[model samples]
Target: MPVRPLSPELAEKARNELNETDENKMVDSLQHLKDWLAKQPYLKARTDDQWLAAFLRGCKFSLERTKQKIDLFYTLKKTAPELTPLKYKDPKFSEILDLGVSIVLPKTSNPAEPRILLMRPGLYDPNKYSLGDVMSVGAVIQNIMLMDDDNFVVAGGISIIDLQGCTMAHFAQMNPMLMKKMTVAFQEAAPVRMKGVHYLNTPPGFETIFNFIKGFLNEKNKKRLYVHNTDFESLYKYLPKEVLPTEYGGNAGTAREFTENTKKKILEYSAWLDEEHLYGTEESKRPGKPKTAEELFGVEGSFRQLQKVIMIRELSPDLAHIAKTELNEDPKQTPEDIKHLREWIMKQTHLKARTDHQWLVAMLRGCKFSLERVKEKLDLYYTLRTTSPEVTLRLKPTQPTFINFLRLGTCIILPKATTGLHPRVILIRAGRYDPEKNSVADIMCILYYMVQILVMEDDSATVIGTKIVVDYEGTTLNHLVQANVTLLRKIVAVSQDSLPLRLKGSHHLNVPSGIETIFKLVSAFISEKAKQRLKIHKSADELFEHIPKDVMPPEYGGNGATVAENIEYWITKIREYKSWMEVEERLGTDESRRLGSLPSDEAGDKGSFRQLNID
Candidate 1:
């Protein structure tokens, strides 16, 4: 765990640049700062002398700056809860460290040599760990570095971020709020001077992520940002091979070796990390009111503010006219009618919904503002929510299983809405489905979430219906065997009878040899009229004939964006609706008032095999 010490020649050079000609004067400055901190009742116990010296050096022996930095550092640790209670021994921490996603190179004291920190975000597994976990490790690493008087504070460090294999799945795991806190902690609180940030092998559409990080950076650090754009030669100019690890074509040992050594070094400093946990700011000691998380990190006028952004687009005049004509209602009466429906539904004995105007409007549009149909569907929707706990309760989008399922890129919503087609195109990659890991209920929950959001976005689209394209290239017999028949029946029943959606069309593409079995299971729940809309295609060409390639992903010879890009887009949208989903979680039907309905306790005793055919 012993790190390489700085060479004498480099030490002298750095000391000269820092204007630390008098060693005794620097020592006195640090002592004065510690003494001042000890007298402050508002602050916690003084940190160790080594940490004090590191801060002194980081601020170039400036006592005032060092004191200011120390206060902010501890204050951030207190305000940002994620930074405290350091869990270096946690299994998730070990897993992330073992992946070698982020590694600090061996220490070098040479002011000329860059203290390089390498980060390979692609090494992160979205299914195993979240971005918050990654940032937690970062806080620990930064703490360890802060304790190092020679390596980090003396010469500073530059980062090389490799985003070669980064995908939407990885980006989706990033928590913006946590990211903002981490950025602020590093830039304002920590003593490390970030010399430069180099992004190597930058992927497409990285601007979205880059801009996000840039928002938190100060003007000075913004100038230090350099995107290599797949150019390693440019990176080599700043970070020579001799200083980099073998993985980056440098003479240093393999990244794995450096990773293991650094991890062991961190483990050895467990006591220090534990002590650091108790050193956060005591907000109660503040002279004035302490800042909230939103007050500190929430950006004003940023698109990231979900509450401010209007997610539901206004219905066009043509779509509004279509709804009026189809439902036999006056165009101007739709708003009042929806309000009435909302009030009436809230009064119903069986259904329990907060019944917001937006939700009511979606239902009205789904049934083309037909009051009777809206009432029926509303009753059935709440009933399903109440009974189907397996699907509704356990299916959280934040769950690892759901995240991995989305990462499979099996279920994709096409970016472009097809002309003259009211329903949005949803492409399902059946081959990617692993029945062993996932049940039909899981799939039903995901579909329900997606359709619910889509319906709310556009009422016209819900009325017209959703188009589904199932790609069965990889479907297997094992998948069919593992499919839960009971869940599948419930899914179909919910879609056909309860959900506010039109059965536009179902296209089966790259139909597998065993598709007949899958088709039979799916078709059993729908009517003959719905079955007539099912189209089976042996190849992409045949599938394209029914559903134009223009509205499909680029991978399928379409003009729209790639499936990965589409996934990224939807992931952002899904995150924005997290608040709405939380409200929906409480919604259900009170079945006690229904005629012949069993009591809540006896409901489970009744046969679970009662199936509602969608047709």
Candidate 2:
């Protein structure tokens, strides 16, 4: 959680418009809203304090407007479940997501820079997934961005709707009522400040859909909409090509690649989307009579039109060839392999393992489809969880201390992995440690959680091994004292013997003077084979020879994103899997159910293990 420094321009805007120039005012505003909302019985949705502050900021710190928008936000969820559905896992919704209809661009010029959302309705099939589904997918993406405190709150958003191949049939398929619902939801319910909407290459008869949509938008937003009919030059006047994707004559990757990456992100945050669905207003529990859909929107039959026949888009020869190549190159496990692995695990009565296909596939891929190895790893994996309560039971991610440790960016899994080996890179900012707050056990717990998540996310490339970059720029003798030798041994033992991953390479960057003593103490516990893979680099430039700079964060003179942004991405991902992690507490090998007794040397004595200190 790096503190986003407010630009002078943004600071002035906050002072003049929102009257919130400092932390104290923001805190007071948030507290005021929380107290006000506590008295509103109808507003049942669990509101985050940070989100409340965002709402206040959006409304220029006007409490009355904020309250109104909050009420309408939950109300829209109840009335427009079609577009604001409770879940994104629905098959049709997922299809739209997979089709790459809409995506939020990755890089922003600055912290206060507005995000550009690119939408290509021409590439999708309206017959298979409706226009409402497209809007729903976009809404989900917007909601996820809104959760980012720095990106959406400080900066706003802009949209580029490419209508190059839109046909009259597509317009006929559009449900005006659904369009109205989506428009109202975006304008009133969502906290996003839509700076503008650019329509690219608008085809003939596009006015039919445009007019219908504009009828619902407010005058302010209606003025913000721009129709650029085939004039890329004019569109570039408003949005520079530097910020746009290559397909749109921008520097980023191809539009197809951007869309695919966006789909992956949507899937990564699906759990968060599902949790959001639960926070909406529970209409059934309302004290007053709930408003009916018909009463709210008037007779819906007025906006109904003849449903046109759905048709799938035909891919061009180049795109078709690329799709084929991608399908072949994808390293994900096949359906048949997943099925076989699931069946094999279930049939192994001695293992007493009950797991999903995903978990099994991860293990199988880690072992390169070796069932015996996967089984062994699975047994050890669950055994460690069941036996070592300190690592699994006491490692609660929701705890404040754990979250603070995570925010320190002490350890993060880079988005991209190594090129040749494709092992996921785990960057450990050892210099960021504060021994006063975090102990050796705390560090071990965090490492355990990171490895657990990395293994789960790993495929063939990353599962086999992982690359670790340790930064020891700020090491002191006190830090070495905090690194308990006993705990270090336990961590190394479990990683080597139980975990399925291999330590492919370990690069120590920014090694402080006399830090070799600390490494010597810790290395004594690690095996010689592991020690052989470790390299001590005095500079990031030296480390770049072994680990490519492209995959490393920019803070280390790499081409990738800033360290803060990368850390934020992983934090959001960790929060998304919070529920699953909680369930994992009960998921471990059942020693009582095993056929044979535990091994004498391997098994822990009944009362020898130390007790976990829960804060």
Candidate 3:
């Protein structure tokens, strides 16, 4: 059902109290708010009139207050994700929704009355559900009022808390910091005007906590506080039985009925609810220092312990020549240029990241100091890490799972660059790991880490790009089967989009006959530019002709370090950056805070990998 219009009495109250006398003025103000929202860089806010109107009336058409409330309203979700993500699939949310823990009572036709926000915390098991879950569910009900109930918006609402079966655990969940977030969420974020709060069936020791909590409440709420303690007669003076649930001896449907309908009403506005989580303040663009969760909610500090990353800034004469000629990198200006990019990244609201000088410098060198392209590269780099955790966010370096895989020597980054141009060489041994025990994706994960190590520390890899050599010496039907279109496409997308390592050449060696069938399937997915750089070597002579002897590992009769030695080197390197990875693992796009379209062609080929020309 559509939201019912306010009766004449309520409409007149809005005109007098809310300063909504001039219809033309309200339209102009709404348009002005929309215009202001358009100019904001961080907030992907909703533009609907009904949505914007709630904030306006909540402040009685005071433009400045409305702006502050609007910022806080969206900022609540961004700062307090624990209580803000009240999605439909959350089982705890659904369970509480069914329990009738918090439900709005049926609005009576008496148009002057405000909406009733009923809360029964005693309905839920304190041990099974935390206070955050209850408040998240309650947020949904409160927001439903902000959207659907005119009386709730214009006349405001009252809250009734029935502390019947509550335990000490319930009180413990309402810690100081949590209380602040919940307060900001309900009051400033939702901006529901509170008429009064009546506490029913108050347990022993409730007064102390309640009085302490009064400090967080406004002056208006402190006066409106009432403790009824199971006295329905006393409560009846303030709230008539018609507006209360049957459990409270009212004529309205039972609490279950109200809950079922409230859930349905929530489903009705589900789209708006989903979008609400996406819109929030760009704290970076805020007037003062960007608000951290600590600043916003007074919770624990938001700093992470990261070890200093040792950056190898020294470049060899050969690599320096290649860097300037092939990569367009001028050594003189790169240090200052890296600082500029770092400053830009610090100001970004979406990139909640603190990268070291090496990583930022690597990005600049990879994109050859094109500021725009480097920004794009870093954004996608973090986006994939944040958005695709299972595939890319593997940061546990000391864990046995990754450590064991590193010893397999399936993927190795040769320390020596090729002669002349000094491009780093990475060798991927296709047959090193048994396909039954390890899939292609597993090895790809190892390759992913190795390439990350290459770009961050190696000047040649960052500036002149890296050469990828895949040697399929041990060919099998099972290995080919693992190289399905889906897995290969993700591998290709990661190679093409996310990684900062530019591809100087892609060389394939020792290809078995059945691999031809696999190559045909993979050819359709790789980019045309990547396809042009492709080189298939039939013999050791042909492969050696493309990659010099010094660049090849000792296993291949080159001066480069043996596979085992390189694996040990990487194992030690991975251990050194464990702390750094712990912090970088948290740095990914929230997706919700992005201002415009997703960073261009982000996942590379996206869902249309098959729609490509094959030769």
Candidate 4:
């Protein structure tokens, strides 16, 4: 079923069930603020509604100690009466309260409904927005937070030191240097580590601590500081140098340098994040170690070496051939080229390179360089074709022989049939001795020629033609002669099924000539009792005399051959005698009466005197 438009009732139901109200009020408000800011002239900085929202949040959270919170809110509220909601915005207050609630928000959970007090800046005209103008609200929030007192930790060397107060005694007591070093080492040694410094009693002013951190960070004795995290509440306690350490000695180990460098990097990172917000996990924040080649080149490194190898291999012939030639010429190549080739080979771990021969073959096949140039350019990549017996077993579609067989449409007598060789044998003698091409041509030509002769001509002509061709080719013929004989036998077998037709006193004998040859050849080859029977009926004259003999008698060799031959001969004779019988019948008065009145002996004489139809 197609979806229908939602009805008012359904919309109202959804709203009530979801308890929806001002679903995107915050976002809408932010967008309005952004529009207003965009319309401004001078005050309009390079910022959007999201930036405004973040800035507003920072001002509320950092400006009034609104983010501070005590673990025991109820106890703190009782013990410190000033810890009321109104006092939560006090610049001196450190603890912030979170009202409990449950409403999921993206990127953050809202169980702790923290609220920050905020006030609009009283300075100005709102219609001065301009392109590229920036409102440093986050920077302002950071500044305000730094002005307020908060616990501060400065990490350096192997320690994270408490920078709450300025005194050697306190510094030694806190051991900030050792703490900083430990923090760095711990992170390096283990997968994860964290350390914190707390200032619960007396919070120092922001500038005093900030200046101290700056000095500590500038100290040359401190070890390098790799990573750091700072909260806005404690920003005031940090030294200016802690924000950017690069300013000190082009490094970020000292508090001063860390602060300076970080401020810049974060500013740049923030701008980038705003432009391209590809948010991910904390791990993704850290840049990966530079690749070796990439580090060496500094700029976009050149991969030409690897690319060249690939191109050469792609263009080269099978590496096997190259390797074979190389091995033949010089088994030992130069050390450097060999080493380079080996390195290249090692890089291609997918190749089975356990043996030197295998490795060489792989290289020859993988790379385009010739094996001959292995020493000079170090060639690789050689491939070889493969064959399988499975190919023979595969069933493929082919045209039927009758359909594909081409007919010459013209027939010729065998060039030398009087002799013994078949036509195919003669063609083989004339054609080149190429088993692949010439032999196939000869087979096709002889087969087609045989078919034409069998189907078009009388038996004698076919026999004479085939015989002459066989004789011409002589005994030099091989398989062609055998194929010819087989083909001839097939033609003879087919002819046996054709209908016999009578013409005049003779009958059209449908027996194929090749069948006669086939029988003769088989008789000659087998030398069985059937051979004698076959020879006796080689012609109709020989068989006609034996028609009266019992077909199954030993006199006719006790085989079907004599009867079959006599039957065939009589059929031919009857066909030839047709016209005479027809004329006699048509001219019934005289000829038919005479023929009908003739005695058995006279009739036999007349029939015997009739013209013989010999093929």
Candidate of highest lDDT: 3
Off by over 4 Å in 2: 1-12, 109-111, 267-270, 284-289, 300-615
Q: What is the per-residue lDDT of model 4 for residues 80-153, given as tens digits with 9 covering 90 to 100?
A: 22212232123221111111000101110121211111111111112321000111222222222222201100
Q: Evaluate candidate 4 by giving its C-alpha RMSD to the native, one decimal.
A: 40.9
Ranking of candidates on lDDT, top first: 3, 1, 2, 4
**lDDT of model 2 at residue 59?**
82
lDDT of 1 by residue, 225-251 (tens): 998866778888887777788877888
Q: Can you give the TM-score per candidate against the true fold?
A: 0.50, 0.46, 0.48, 0.14
The clash count for each model shown is: 0, 0, 0, 86
Give the TM-score (vs. native) of candidate 3.
Answer: 0.48
Candidate 1 residue 374 Cα shift, in angstroms, is 29
lDDT for 52 in candidate 2 is 74
What's the residue-level lDDT of 427 in candidate 2?
Answer: 85
Question: Which prediction has more favorable lDDT, 1 or 4?
Answer: 1
